[model samples]
Target: MRRLTKFSSAVVGLTVLAAAGTAVAAADQGDDWPYAHHSAASYTLAAVGDIACEPDDAENAATPASLKCGSPTLGGMSAEFATAKQATAMHPDAVALLGDEQYQVGKLTDFEKSFEQAWGGLKMLERPAPGNHEYYPYAKKGDNEAGQNGAGYFGYFNGHDQAGTPETQGQAGDDTADKQGWYSYNLGNWHVISLNAECKSDAFEHDCSTTDSGLLGQETRWLSHDLAANRRQCTIAYWHQATFSATTASTATVPASAPGAGGAEGAATDAWWKLLYQHHATLILNGHEHAYARLRPMNPAGQYDPAHGIPEFIVGSGGEALDTLAGSPGNYDNPNVVTAQAGAFGVMKLTLRSHSYSWDYKPALPGPGFDSTALKYSDSGSGTCN
Candidate 1:
């Protein structure tokens, strides 16, 4: 009998006890590493999205002023923050972001506000992917339409958090970073990939509109190589925007009604779906839909095609603006889905195991106190492509 010890710090409300099996990040590094084998073995991966936080100044200006500090409109941002603080206080391994890290449009100021508000407490185990709002156009020299949009995002994250490693952080522009905003690392037994959605159009032949090029190009090639290179039993990849979502049809939903919703889907459309399917990704986490929605093991077409169905979790409820919840769970066609509260603000917690994974969605609530009901919906399923 042997005892395993964890190497990475516990993040937010995650717990990683290496009392058994392999190293979690070994999926990328290898079995000989001194860590838990799979995240299933050491810890669980938890996520939240569309966590629209209100800057302290904005709090005073919210519509329904009573719930301003923590309200459905703000995706209960303040509440989720406290909940994450509590969860991490419970001693968890790591916390992840699904995207849409902020609201309105992404700018340096917006990111500063986001960090000050939503990202205030969980800096310990913070990892993220970019959502559409994070890509507000910034005019770069040569690339006008494709000017350096996510400058604010780049400035804030700079790829990975290097506070622990001086070598990785002190270098100029993340030259030490694996790639621009895409990289892989091993933790526990999981091989995790964080990609930038803004780069989805980097190599698209057509305008971003008519291409399935979200995580394509060099990123896709790298992802394929990364997956093939690793032999770990579990792999997880997350991005800010999803290639497939039934949340709102362009014509019917409020987003469509919003001023700039027309080119929204074109942002990261279907580019990553095929690659994910091809790589047999075990779990795909994403945000941007403002509500929480979990797709059954699915394929490129958004169908319940289970043969290689990768369980996709849309945990975009991270204290942001709540989109209209869809009327029903499986209805991807309805246009007027104001009742679709699945878009409430919150986060998802995943307990990964060697052979199975379980996920729970915790939504935001008014809080001078926390609610156990926040942990209302929970689901567990066996590994599919493993």
Candidate 2:
């Protein structure tokens, strides 16, 4: 496993260690020197979302088939476990859990039985954001069901006490009525923000307007403050749903007016995209679409802008069943989508540098019905900071 060199303040006076571990005199160091004491010149991050299937999913009980626990047919490995192994193989400095980490209402018992069995090992290194499944019950069918309201998400990521004190829930974000899981932190030289996109869920009473006088408004205000106070040259923000999408489960082609086209649920994030764009955020990672898509850099309006646009990547192909692409197999309907795939379960590996970043989507396992060759699907590229 590769390791990041830890340089002490004493060494800063004489020589600064570059990302490549070459010793350079402090006098020759550039202005981009990392200010954080523990900052690394470069680091790796493995990211994915829409992970473990519900432990009680009917597929688990099917003859010669199991989707929750490992199956003997697949060498005693579940899809989630296979992707977890793929992520662990990278030895990333941190894992950005995009969200929808546990399916079917995200109950605590389900997380422990399914998600934990595979992803628990990376819990300490995981930076999480909540998804609809974490907040709503029965996938938002009526909102009257017994929902965890992020209790399972917070309880698992923050600790066991579902109704614990603020400190216990700090890691996952405050799940109170006012603050709905939005926080920012510095990683290496980049500012990483995790925002909860379930603003319209039952937890928030379906009020996601900027003037919503509730969690939505509070979250937006906090995000604005966070962005204003950030000083990092490179920034990235993540949540569950995306402002741009390449697929919707019900239809092969998403209508322009649908929520999948940044309408309903995705529209709730318009303010967020605007703020990040204004702040020159470098990337936006999302995972509610149940497929993988690499969109070209674009403004908050969804217009392609190579110069000052924030690119978005939908990496929902973590472990759950894959969704269809926007159009025919080879042709994607969304013009902004540069590339997309639906049959491969994978993790996006990000190599973050002081002033730039690179991404490599590594397929771990094939989804149902896909042959072994599906594992060969790949998407990789490098980009400089905005």
lDDT of each: 0.50, 0.72
- Which candidate achieves the best lDDT against the true structure? 2
- Candidate 1 lDDT over 1-386, as tens digits, reads 11111111013222232211112333343442222232345565667766655344553242334323344335445555754654454334556776666544444455566554556465545566666656544233221222224454555654334442222331111222234455665544666777655553332222343234433455666766777887766778887666555356322433322222314443343556666667767778877766666555665655555566666666666665555544454454432211224523455677665645555555445322334543454343334226
Worst 10 residues of 2 by lDDT: 1-10
Residue pairs with backbone overlap in model 2: none
Clashes of each: 43, 0
C-alpha TM-scores of all predictions? 0.66, 0.82
Could you tell me how far off, in angstroms, the CA of residue 200 lies in candidate 1 after the best superposition? 7.8
lDDT of 2 by residue, 51-151 (tens): 98767545324322343334332212378899998987776666789988987678777787888989888775677888887887662422333567888
lDDT score, residue 206, model 1?
23
Candidate that would win on TM-score: 2
What TM-score quantifies how close candidate 1 is to the native fold?
0.66
